[model samples]
Target: MVIQEQIRIQTRGRNTYNITGEVSEAIGRAGIETGICQLFIQHTSASLILCENADPSVRTDLERIMSRLVPDGDPIFDHTLEGPDDMPAHVRSILTHMDLSLPISQGRPALGTWQGIYLWEHRTHPHQRNVTLTL
Candidate 1:
């Protein structure tokens, strides 16, 4: 069976959000015991990632590194109409990912002990993000 659904995530700006529980819930709802669950973020300014969720410091360091790698308000970007962060947001998404595919076992995402699903918001302001899950 193929099941598809979307979840709305409200983010407080550029940060990694742990959506592991949400995804597991979706898998439970789907009632698929041993399948694959794919997650896709339906936005250009945001992305998805699977990373270490055991430590908050990992996320903090990632945010810091990303900011340095793609500093906002750079004069090099031409798509500045929406604001300095607009173009940088797009770039950040490009550098990251738009989707993730994880194995589902016993109605739970087969993630590692230290791994978690994350929605990486690239924007500087809060926004409603939609994540489509296919199981």
Candidate 2:
């Protein structure tokens, strides 16, 4: 079975927002008996990842590590058209991912109990983001 769905999310900015529930709900609605559900983030300034949902601190640490690894305002970056976060955003996206394919079984996404989907907001300000689901 093949399924297509789109979801818009409003971010507070610069953080990972858990979106597992939304993706799972969309998959359920699609009624795909068995397949792989692919998730694509329609933006370069953001990323997609499966993260530990059991603890909020894990997300926090991830953000901190990413920030340190690709801190804003590096002297070598030339794509600062948006701001310091612009180049940093690209770097973060490079380190992470923009699309993910998940196993779907029994009309549900096969996710571990403690694993969750996240939209890693790389921008420095709040904005609306698009999530496309394809199964």
Cα lDDT tens digits, model 1, 24-74, are 998988889998999999999999999999999999999999999999999
The local lDDT score (0 to 100) that residue 17 gets in candidate 2 is 92
Best by TM-score: 1
The TM-score, computed over Cα atoms with residue i paired to residue i, of candidate 1 is 0.98
- Show where candidate 1 strays beyond 4 Å: none
| Model 2: how far residue 12 lies from native, Å | 0.9
User: Candidate 2 lDDT, tens digit per residue, 1-135?
Assistant: 466889998999899998987988898888777899999999999999999999999999998899789989988899999999999998899789999999988878888988899999999899899999987
Q: How many steric clashes between backbone atoms does each model show?
A: 0, 0
Q: Please, what is the TM-score per model?
A: 0.98, 0.95
